[model samples]
Target: MNKRPSILIVDDEVSNIEILSAVLEEDHDIYFATSGDEAIATARAALPDLILLDVLMPGTDGYEVCTSLKGDPLLADVPVIFTTALGDQEAEVKGLELGAIDYIAKPISPVVVRARVRNHLEMKRMRDDLAKLAVTDALTGLGNRRRLEQALNIETARLALTSGTLSVIILDIDFFKRFNDLYGHTAGDRCLTMVAAALNRAVHHASDLTIRYGGEEFACVLPETEHDRAMDIAHGIRERVEALNIPHSGSDVAATVSVSIGVATAACVPGATPEAWVKAADAELYKAKAAGRNSVSGRTFQVVVEDARPLSSTA
Candidate 1:
């Protein structure tokens, strides 16, 4: 069963908060904030799906609160509805300009409030679903290359500030073309899905992300992980893929489906970029292919060198 969507009712008046809560509590998980500051804090903590905001609260009014919420990257996408007595055109325009999805005038009608809330919540759910689909791979259900690059960039910046380490593993199916040609494209897609699932299972950490990096290739981003552990994870992925037992008679590497993995680990440093990290992993992948398929190659860098120099394998 789906969990109830959460809503935050922000109003200074206890009576108003209670009324909105009673209206929404049956269908939604409801939270109350008596002031704008409290509302902001609660929204950040709870990340409610929808907010019902009163316009005339003391200290920080609904307009200011909505602005703050819209400015926040984490909270910006959350839908906000202004529940206020000021039903004038100017007030509604200002609220909309500040990123509110709807404006509800007081004295509130329970039925209208309920219907609008349901409609807005449903719309938000659809929007969220679409956004997720945009970044997700359709065949493998893993994050797509764009999503992986975005995550890599964000992690690189974060670790740069903390002087931490980040690792990447790039892997591809051995003799995938021959497998596809022999088994047909349909079977090839199934094999790719199976490999993606194995890679996903092998990562095992919430902080790690597995992504489908285009056709027949996948990548894993391991944040705050060092060289040895990264290599272990890569090898584990290789073992898992081989154990899938998907037959690949066209390949010479193994009787069953197998993969080659390349691992690159680096400490965050000046001039480090996500592209360079990926290139390092790609180079290691080249080495893995050179050494023969169904193997893992890895390298660790102390700091990012901006000279575009070739990276040597540490293992």
Candidate 2:
């Protein structure tokens, strides 16, 4: 969608407001607020893409306004820039510390103002795009396995330093081979996408990842979590899959989309290794399959044994 950048200009001086508006008008849809109260009201109603506030405004200066805007979760991500006559080092530092993305000095150069505004907006655009790419699976539009591994590593590192806990889950759709056989490969592709949507919808954490680990299997990684919690997450995954009501002709019930999951956690894996963690998780996964076809099994184990010992204190 082609949309103009929306900017809210807050200043006590009408002349400064007019000057800034003239400078930014071509590149943005400019809105002016002579007082902090009006600025806040306009910001709430329109939710401008960016905000430019004057530091020396009367009754709730830019600093207080910036602080208030940041306190709101909905407004928190909107980048703010301070347009202040106080162009010294101290003012710049204060504005930055208050979470302003950029600082603009007074006697504004149209070129400098335009360049900086465009720069911050472009940077934000790139950042949001990069963040989405990092977490997304290219084929399935689901979270990728790399996302899962990263979440696990962060939790494990935190636990290694502070003795916390972490958990993971490995889920595989049972008899998925028969699904491919009866429905043909193209239908199998649709089945995967449907199941991935269910997994994505079922997961609740921003940090949590739902991965299409490979053909017919998926994984979920949980941080600051334990085996029991992992099991609960797995059950939710299974239930969500079934709730899709996707037909499985080869299975019983005439309508069955199920997964067998293995889950594991570690509070104090005395010695941790990626291999050890995967083995533990896989072992529990096997246990789930052995016990039944549509259930979750939980396991917890201590970390021990690594080839590199004394030198790897980080372990």
Candidate 3:
């Protein structure tokens, strides 16, 4: 079942909190914070869909809270609505400047509050859906290259901070053009879809992203994975795709459809970039293609230095 939208109601007065909760409780999972400090902490923890902030407070007023929330990357997109008794145009402009989507004046009208909350939440839902579609591949329903890059950037940044490991595997359909030439585009598409599913099944973790990187090329981003584990996964992808037994009468590789895979694992260091990480994997893919198709090649970087340059590499 889908979860209810969550709202954080912030007010120093218990009475105001009660009144707001009474109005919104039926439709939303409500969380409360009594002061600005508590509000920021709760917002980080709860990640509420919308925040109803009371402007006047003892310390860390609503404007300050909104500024803090908007500054945070994770919480920035959350909608914040200021509930202020202050009726001046200047005050309203101040709240809007701090990134609050709408302002609800006190003594809060239940009807107006509900309508505004519903509208903003609906708009947020539409935006979230469109963002998902933008990074998704239309053909095989796998994440597209844009999604791959975004995931890689996120993982690389996180690992760089923690000095952890990251891995990437790039896979190419062996003799794919020949397969299309022999089988026609429809069968070729079917083969690609089957291969995508095989890759999906090969990756076990929720954090592992399998992407259709581009025509006949796919990639996987495995965060915090080691070289041996990544190599095992690369080999697993290769075995699974070949097991599908899609005939490839095109010369060489194998009778059934197969893929060439290359993997690169790195112990992340500061200043690492996603582009450098992908290039390392792509270099290995070239080696796999050079040696022969239908094989897996892997390597490891001892440490990624400034600008994602590897300090050392090992086969």
What C-alpha lDDT values do all the predictions have? 0.88, 0.77, 0.89
Q: lDDT tens string, model 2, 49-163?
A: 8899999888988999999888754467789999987868988898889999888887898899989989888887787689679877776887666655554554554456567
Q: Per-residue lDDT of 1-315 in model 3, one digit per residue for the tens?
A: 998999999999999999999999999999999999999989877989999999999989989999999976457889999998889899999889889899999999999999999999999999888988998999999998878866776577557767889999999999999999998999999999999999999999988999998999999999999999999999999999989999988849698898988899987767676677688899999999998889999999764355653223111
TM-scores of the models, in the given order? 0.74, 0.57, 0.80
lDDT of 1 at 50: 96
Superposed model 3: Cα runs more than 4 Å off? 9-22, 30-47, 54-73, 157-165, 224-228, 267-271, 302-315
lDDT of 3 at 5: 98
Better-scoring candidate (TM-score), 2 or 3: 3
**Model 3: which residue pairs collide?**
none
Query: Which candidate, 1 or 2, would have the higher TM-score against the true structure?
Result: 1
Model 1 whole-model lDDT (C-alpha atoms): 0.88
Error of 1 at 60 (Å): 4.4
Worst 10-residue lDDT window, candidate 2: 306-315
RMSD of each predicted structure: 6.0, 10.0, 5.0
The true-versus-predicted C-alpha distance at residue 251 of model 1, in Å, is 4.4
